[model samples]
Target chain A: MLHTLPELVNQRTTLVRRGRFLCVDFRLSVGDVDYDITVNHGRLVGFTSDGGLLRSWRFRIAAPAQTWLAFWQPVPAPGYHDIFALNKSRLARLEGDLYPFMSNLRYFKEVIAIPRDFNFTTEQDLVA
Target chain B: MSASLEPIVGRYLRTTWQQRPVRIYFEEAGNGIPLVCLHTAGCDTSQFRHLMTDPAVTDRFRVIAFDLPWHGKSPPPVGWQDEDYALSTDAYTEIIRTFCRDLELVKPVVMGCSMGGRIVLNLAAHHANEFAALIGLEAADHQTPWYDTEWLNRPDVHGGEVCAGLISGLVAPQSPDEARWETLWQYLQSGPGVFKGDLHFYRADSDYRDRTALIDTAVCPLYLMTGEYDFSCTVEDTTRTGAAIDGAEVVIMGELGHFPMSENPVKFRQYILPVLDEIEKKSAPKS
Candidate 1:
């Protein structure tokens, strides 16, 4: 049971209910660093850097640190505004099974776009 | 009476195009020279919901938006069960022409976005003498499609969710949450395989590159405005298209994307009102 997913998913009761059917885990890479992203029933449980090699993920969405920085901005630029746009512009690379990615596309989009409040003055801080 | 009526009125019109008769559902508001609106692929008359209600426009222009068959509120033409709905350029052109003639709109201004945008170029190329002007929003001669549309129709995924999800990115992040989600809601309401079916026109059937040189803006003014954030029809695409047409007016709107009118009507109005005003002046009786 997802006791805390509501709070995690914008505290929206509706999303919390809908999240029940969603279960996806993936790896997000910014530069050389890899962050294991887990979405258990629609809740973005966590995205922590350094997933052990033994851990498995369905897909990997990788981008340059600068691309991640541009995307995380409260208001992103034209080409960097969307994951698909990034992939289209070759600013980001999405690999592995796209089935899961397309299956819960909205969930993946919203979860990734939850907007990080982190204040990073440089690509180094973002990668850190 | 707590039930106040909106100024808009809904109605049905019958028109036959390409030997195929279809019942079209259209909504209208305001009163003046008819301004026929064409919505983006997979969307319907609802995209013009805000445009119809805006008094600034309604006072001078009669805004009318119609749903294509197999789209919102409009059912497919009879005998559709055996056919897959594919909107060809010839069919789309004839539909608008027949619709305008049936409605008795005298030289109505035709404005459209996306696939609708592509067709206006065809309209100008072949039928400029019949209309007052042409406005193409998020238009281009051509742009390679960014994503495969197969994901939108597959049984493995929820069709509505996938369609709305893919389209959500096309709306600019600067758009208000209310307007943005409402735009997605419209996509969410699109029928099964309908969005993909419409892509038959947008992704495959419509390419105006070779045809742009044939459009003569002298017969009817052509205005091409594209939102800055529309990756699907990039600013470069609109500008290149504009350059190909000698006298076309080109504009790059800021902080908006593919579905400019639906996703950010307020901002779209700021850019569009001026064009409408210009059109009114162009059509005014010379004294």
Candidate 2:
């Protein structure tokens, strides 16, 4: 269900602009795929579905497919609401550099919430 | 719970332990034993808004919730911004003490969540005679190492949104959308850097690991409760904190979050009512 995240990220301009002052790299691991994203001066310069560049990013925020589904809900419940809560409860893992992730925390938070705007009828819509 | 009983709102004017002029916002309802409720860091008196109106609580005891300085309706102390508002253990304890003293609340039962939860331990340790009992909701001896405050204090960062996102994540997934959003709205409305300032005390200054031994339950009973979904202060954390304090009763709330009382009032009341009943029974004189 998380396959369309890259396309969604590219379509959201305001989300990108929110991180304008942030210049760093990060990764998002959903289910089995890893999405490597790079932002320079708050602009998303690169986003790829390839798992090979996993270690190149500063940090990776990873959660299970089910967890991401709940998080991307229009209004998430407790465990899926925030990335930090996920980490605190041991539901999600944040690895590698945490500086960029924390410094530009709001930008990344809003960026991740972009999926709430999408309409999905089934789990396959996110995966396919 | 009743829709009819509303709290009488008032301002508590008192000098902090530091002797700063502070006006604390408070709401109280019902009569009997005083239950002084404290909200989590970055939150306000509204956390106990429902409890204040609940007859099950008010019929047996007087419930009160107050906003700390730099939070909710309470403005920050004088020279707050230039010096940056920081809540130390002494300052936190003193404010609670001063508020109770000024209100002439004799031996009130104190309960708090998160930062407020942690502070109650200090209140028990240092001010045993001041309260009838202590309840720490989501209380723990220390914050998990996963929490980091570095970026939270950054001038360039929009901390209010980030703080809201961080806190809103700890609410139960089964909670009503209205309840969840209402919780989030409070975080969103918090002052700039206020959440982070509170975190400085919550994540850093409020560690009770070395001090829990000071709490003597014989003088005042202590109870600790944590939500199943509270990742920050998990069941394990609260359990360990309970073990540290002698004779402290620990309860793990299922399908709840950090902000139990505010997140789901009806569900939270189920857990709280029993504890309040026990306290009232103990206070009753003679068989």
Candidate 3:
């Protein structure tokens, strides 16, 4: 069970390869906690929990923990289906340089979706 | 079990009403009467990729779509940074005029969605002489109150993500996963602030409530079809707009959304085919 997004990205080689040309950096804000991630030459080179905001990053996608839980499901519901859907409904926020985020949208979307394959569990839905 | 036919993709350079050099990207497929398609705002000509390839549609119509000046493969006009890139009625109408004239599409059937939908009505009102008919998908006279543009333009807000999020809501609730995802992907790939720029026209600049009277359907047939899930341009809203225009046809598409043409092309085609058939029958040579 992959517990964190950083760990999930590092393990997904194919996903990383799919985004090799996306030599940009972005952050994912899960609830109040922020994870700084970097994709360099199609490799997941940096995945760290930053204490402060990484202002230099191309974009920062922030959503509530509950929103992310629904989104990461193998099959997501209406509001959780797409990151932009969340933004439309005011459930999530995307801030910073939008060009890189828009231009390389598919690469980042797949990269974020990698964790869905991992059977991770939180206290809310832990089977064990 | 589908036959594949590729569209001829090309670029056209034109000096738009904005007096800037703009490269408009376009795609064309099939033959027969010309049918020029306009993409939703913030998206490019690629939204019609599947429609252009559909043999059923292509056999009787020459389908064409073009990227607006700043959307898709077409970059912003020179000195774009100096002025805010809000899509005005004049600029929007002029681009369409120049595009059709440049291509020599005699009496083409014009179709559009969302922002494109709104503009086609304007095209009918002012330039009815140019087109044979007008098809407006998700067309409305005013923007819904739910569309909040302030936060979307904030400096810290990621324009792309929020744009995708907001626009994704308009996709039909039952749209195919691939089709829905592909529609959202267009918003994700749009140029920075392009969606917002387009919305400036969609939300505030493009109200046709009073002006709808000017749309003479006899001059150019008017048809408005809105998706059931298009909360922004709900069926009621579209019907209200259609009621204002004389001889305008109105339709409500079940299981479709604001981005119906792209979100579910098959369903959209089903709705559109009958309308096209009617147009062809009416326009057929009177023996």
Candidate 4:
């Protein structure tokens, strides 16, 4: 799911329109791994595993890999149903500046749940 | 253009809150016992639109839904520029009590959701004699607050949209797309900060745990119903609330979340109709 996050997001042009004015970077931590992601005008432009200094992001959304696994399921249940739900239940943690995140909330939520919408795992599809 | 008229009527009532002149906007339909609805925090009375328009409900019960001051069509108390709005327990109860008196309603069975839900406990505990029955939807004596209320009110945020976005997940995933968005549209149109102002009572001011044991069900039977999908007021919250109050009845609504009536009126009807029927029966004079 993490590997395909960019593809899954870029494919949904209609969903990205809602946050077309937003341009920011954010961090996603699944287990011990981290991905520094950049979104430009609502499209996921790039992301990398580069660590150390000079990295900046509007916010960081971190949860255990298992938590993300449950969240990415085709049909998550209850607390796993939404990011805010996960945050409320304390299964996931959100830190750093929340301005961009809150201002573009619906877009952010829709973008992150792309995996749920596509349920992608195919390498051929990922190559696209 | 094609348009259909609903039997529902909207009107404003002349009233007062703590010696200040006030006006309340409400919509009503049907003809029997008054079913005054209290909407969730920040949002207004539209949450009960389906119930008010349904013949099954209105044919036998007069349904009334009102916007609390500073919500929907109801404006805040005067002296406009200087005050920050906050709802208190006494103020909330008084608003309902006065609305009833102004309408000349006798023993109206009150049903409220979310903030409306929590306040029912206050009504049950201190003013039970004024109501024939109390129904609390997505209700609990208390639930822990999960977010900073300021986010819903601050200047940098689009209060209405952010507010709607935050709560959209609270609606059941099974609800129809139409009903779900309709519920969100209401939040998108909410007055700035009104949702947070109402929270003054929900998360802080209206904690009913200390007084739950004081409610006498024999006076006004209390009913607790919560959606299975509501994390804010989980089933456990309502269950624990029901247990604390003797004779309180609890029901868990399936495939529904916090905003039951508004988000999925079709499914909510299945759960609420029986309860409404029981209330109708209870109010019927003995033969």
TM-score of every model?
0.94, 0.82, 0.70, 0.95
Show where candidate 3 strays beyond 4 Å: A1-128, B1-5
lDDT of 3 by residue, B1-287 (tens): 99974566565656555676677878788898888989998889888888888888899889989888889877888788876678888788888888898889999999998889999988988889888889998888775656456645557656776677667657765799999989988887777778778888887788877688888898989899998767677778898898888799999998788887789988988898899998887778899
Which scores better on TM-score, 2 or 4?
4
Query: What lDDT is obtained when candidate 2 is compared to the true structure?
Result: 0.80
What TM-score does model 4 achieve against the real structure?
Answer: 0.95
Better of 2 and 4 by DockQ: 4
Writing each residue's lDDT as its tens digit, candidate 1 over B33-71 gives 899999888889889999999999999999999998889
Clashing pairs in 4: none
lDDT of 1 by residue, A31-111 (tens): 888878677776667666654576678899999988888988878889889998898888999998888888877777766
Per-residue lDDT of B248 in model 2: 97
lDDT of 4 at A116: 69
| Cα deviation of A93, candidate 3, in Å | 16
Q: What is the TM-score of chain B alone in each candidate?
A: 0.97, 0.94, 0.94, 0.98
lDDT score for residue B107 of model 3: 92
Evaluated at residue A96, the lDDT of candidate 1 is 84
Candidate 2 segments whose C-alpha is farther than 4 A from its true place: A6-26, A37-47, A51-59, A63-82, A86-128, B1-5
Quick one: best TM-score, which candidate? 4
User: Residue pairs in steric clash, candidate 1?
Assistant: none
Q: After the best TM-score superposition of candidate 2, give how far the Cα of residue B231 lies from its true spot, in angstroms.
A: 1.2
